[model samples]
Target chain A: MRFIDARCQLGRRCVIRENEPVTKAEILELMDRCRIERAVAYHAIAKEGDVKAGNMELLKDTEGDSRFLRQWVALPHTFGEFMSVEELLKGMKENSVSSIRMFPKTHGYSLKPYALGKFMDAMAEHKIPVFMTYNELASEDALYAMLTDYPKVNFIISDVSYREERKLFPILEHCPNFHIGTGNYVVHGGVKTMCEYFGAERMIFDTGLPTGSAAAAVSLICFAEISEEEKTLIASGNLERMLSEVEL
Target chain B: MRFFDASCRLGRPAAFGEGMPWQTDEILEIMARCHIDGALAYHIVAREGETQDGNELLLREIAQIPQLQPQWCALPATYDEFLHADALRDAMKENGVRTLRIAPKSFAHSARPYAMKELMGFAAECRVPVFFDYGEAPCDELYEICHDYPDVSFVITNTAYALNRWLGPVLDACGNLYLGTGNYVPHRGLETFCKYYAADRLVFNTNLPTGSATAAVSLVCFADISKEEKELIAHGNIERLLGEVRL
Candidate 1:
């Protein structure tokens, strides 16, 4: 089945070996290998520091490639490093950046609703999707609070494990804008069960590319017990709908 | 791609999930769905209940299915709660047991190299593979056992991520050490592992019913290595190791 990876990264990872940057060609080649039609990617260096520089680099790197959907990193308001929420949204709109990722722990901000009120408000108003991996949301309480407070904001939780359903189900029940990226969600019969309860639209395909195995993720979705229509939703349809709905 | 799953389980999990009965038929069905040809499985009863009863149950469950290889849990030599050295070997031969696993952390047993010296020696002498998974024994102690008993083939199963630092040296030093790729996926990790070490040291495993077998198989199948290397990791290496077992 054709796929559009909702979560991906490029650039030097801080924790791993130095100077091991993955080129756009390599990312595209990996996409071809894994049968991914497109990928939404952020710069890994953005998670380290200087998100502005990282985001700019990500934009520059994917300049000519339409397949590489650009995503910027959102820093805390107190940092005063980037433009105000209004200006940031305007810039993102002009640049065709549809989504943004968060690194709360790295940026030294509490992800409580109050701390991110301004940023979350802008994202909600603009209908921009927010992506948070394990690096951002570490606790269920914090995630619950954020989703509860920002009811309008679309949040995509990527690289989530299947065992986290116990903690995630309660939040999911109440939050309608929440979606899951199936990179690490490899629990046996999890996709089928989740599709049954949550509907297929709430799930999106992701490989956790450049950090995890793309083949593994694709194989998981292909072998899942869900229907072909459900697989199509998770593979690319849901991601395309979310991205297209992004109000410039 | 046919898989000889080195890490799998039968019976219910102790603390996690619903008490779903994971019988032999269910295991075979799951394996078939995932393109797995056979599995080396231990009974959850062996881990939670008495060892002997668990072993007998394991044997009974896999009696008809030759693909489901039974692995018994070994205890310390001092307790004699289970058979030791020669007797253990005799029992293994009689029961068609080719592999053994130990859960030191869960069973409250010491992981010192000397604790299971006799069993390790017997396993090495008999060319049987003794397996350990995450939480069973610390890597350092496992290294010590592998170092002390170079003749014994030691298989480390269900390894966690970000363990390359600890594993690199142990695997480098010990030729007998093999890794079960149940949860070992890092960025281009399988390729790097093949580059640094021999491809034969890596074995295909599912950690099935608990972990995704398809994920494990796809990791090797789509790795950026030669077809021969992929074949070795997929089933050839483990098949060679299993072929050495006398029983």
Candidate 2:
């Protein structure tokens, strides 16, 4: 099955271990090994250093690279530190970027509608899906609040370990736009159970590459006990549909 | 490509997610589906509290199932709470059991030599491999235990992605320390690990009934390593470890 990784980071960041893949060539080689057709990649600097410079680094690093789909890290435009909502949308359109990632916990921003109302509103209008890891939220309750606050914006949370089933289930039941990245959801039969309860459309395939395991991520979907059609949807179908809906 | 899972749990957990495959039959089915040929399983009853009964319970539960091998939970034998060295060895030998699992934090005992000397000494003499979750020993305690019982092969299981910084140093200092590749999900984790430490140190595991067998198997199979290294991780290394048990 063709897989499109919905969560990946490009460019160098701080704290790289001895043999961990750090360069774009290494990341692409790993992706190729796992048969990932494309990855929705943001900049590591955007996450760890400066958002604006990191976003630009992502574009430059992934230039002429069809294997990576551009995803820019977004920050609230408070104090004029970042681009306005209109400018952000215009840049996304011009650059052919289709998705946006947020690091509220790392970037020190609030997810309340007060902080992200206009930005999220534009995302909803453009059908641009928002991506973040589970660590970005203060709690599952906060995640629920943000999802309900901007119900139209699709949010895909990645690296949610196997421990949050009871907490995440209620949110999944209530929130239609909250999708899970099936990269490290290593709960035994978790993919099957999630499909059974919420359907396969709610899961988007992501590897969290250069840090997350692309081999294990693809294996989770490929060997899941769900039906072939459900596997297809999670592997690439849902993400393809989500990106295709981007008005930008 | 046969996999012998080094870390698996039997019996129902105190708390579990909806539709989690905790039953023995369900675990076996999942193992079969994942092409896992055998497993070294510890029982939750023993791990939660009842050390003696839980160890015995593990035997009965997997008595008929050849695919499930018994991995007994060990305590320090304070106040005669568990089997002494001789009795434990006799019991393990009688049952064809080749390994032991410890939980210092859950059992509320120090992993230092004062508490674990006797049990760890038996493990060293018998060449029996000892297993535990990373939470039980953690960072410094993990290093101390490996140093404390250098002869005993120690396998740390159920490790998530955030432990590379802490775990790397311990692996560097301790030759006895082995890693259970159940949920070690760092990108290029296996490849990186094999580069610094050879593939012999990575024992294949599913952490099944809680950890994903599919993800664990795929991590080994699809890792960017040689076929020989993959064989060593998939079953060869674990087989060697179990084979070395003189019990």
Candidate 3:
């Protein structure tokens, strides 16, 4: 089945291990091998170095590459250091970017309504999904708060390890907009269980590529004990629908 | 593409997700579904605490099941609280148990030679491969244990991503250290590991009941490595290690 990676990092980042896929060519080769038709990619510089510069770097790196759907790393515009909501939306439309990723913990911003009320409001208005790793939030409590606070906004949290099922289940029960990125959710029979409880629509297939395992990510869906319909939705359909819904 | 899971836990966990496969039948169903040929399973009772009792429980649980091999949890035999080296060896030999697992941190013991010399020495002498989670002997402790028991094959499992930086140096320094590729999900993790360390040091495991067998097997099957290398990682390396067990 065709796959679309929901989370991927383009461009080089610090702490690259020996023989890891770094360049666009290497990443594309892997995506092809894994049958990933396209990847929603954000810039590594945006995550690790400079947010604005890295988002721009993502555009340059993925320029003319149809295989990459652009995703920009967003920062809260405190003191006008970053783009205002209007400017951000305008830039996203101009660039054909559909999704936004944030690093509230990494960027040292508050997820409180007071801190991101306007920005999240704009995201909710545009139907643009926001992405982050499970670690980017301080706790499951913070994650619950964020998801409940922005009930209309879609949030796809990735890299949630096997240990947090108890903590995450209640939140998944309460929050319909909280989707999980199936990159490194390596809990045994986890996908099947999630589908059983939360339904297939709640999962968005992702290979935290260039850093996370593409083979493992795709295999998780491919070998899951769930139905073909569930697999199809998780493999690409859910993410495709989410991206297509972005008004920006 | 045959798989012999190098690390799988048996019995119920203290806490588990809904519908997690923990019983022998449930585990067997998953193993069959995933096309796994066999598994080396340690009981949760043994791993959680009661090393000797858990070891005995493992023997009883897998007595009729030929696909599941017993992997006993070991301790330092402190104050005769556990089995000494000789009795442990005899018991393992009689029961056809070839592998051993330890959790120094959980058992509240130092991994140093002063505490682990007798147990590790038995493992070294018999070529019985020792298993432990990365959390049991993490980072510097991982290196120290490998260095201390250079003769024994040390397979570290449940190593999530973010360990390559710390693990790379250990793999370089210790030839006896083997990696359990259960959840070592770094991008191109197996491919990169093979590039640097060779596939012989990489062992395929599922950390089953908790770790995903589907993900583990898929990681090896779809890895961008040679068929020969994949074969070595999938079962050949682990089979070789188990075959060398003198016990």
The number of clashing residue pairs in each candidate reads 0, 0, 1
Q: On residues B100-133, what C-alpha lDDT tens digit does candidate 2 reach at each position? A: 9999999999899888889999999999999999
Per-residue lDDT tens digits for candidate 3, residues A74-143, read 9866534479899999999999999999997777656766457778999999999999999999899999
Off-target runs (Cα >4 Å) in candidate 1 are A1-248, B18-21
Per-residue lDDT of B77-188 in model 3, one digit per residue for the tens? 8899899999999999999999999999999999999999999999999999999999998765787889888999999999987666567657766899999999999888
By lDDT, the candidates rank as 3, 2, 1
What lDDT does candidate 1 reach at residue B240? 91
Model 1 chain A is weakest, by summed lDDT over 10 consecutive residues, at A106-115
Candidate 2: tens digits of C-alpha lDDT, residues A1-248: 89999998887779987788988889988988999999999998999998999989988998898889999999877545589899999999988899999997777556655457778999999999999999998889989989999999999999999999999999999999999999889999999999999999999999888888899999999899999999999999999999999997
TM-score of model 2 vs. true structure: 0.53
What lDDT tens digits, residue by residue, belong to model 1 across residues A1-248?
78999888988675764433366677788789888888898987787757888888888888888898989888754424467788788878877788999876556445544346677888887788999885467588878877888999999998888688898888888999889889999888888988999999999899887877888989888999989999999999998988888887
Q: Which ten residues in a row have the lowest lDDT in candidate 1 chain B?
A: B14-23
**Cα RMSDs of all predictions?**
19.5, 19.7, 19.6
Every model's DockQ, to 2 decimals?
0.01, 0.01, 0.01
State TM-scores per candidate: 0.51, 0.53, 0.53
The lDDT leader among the candidates is: 3
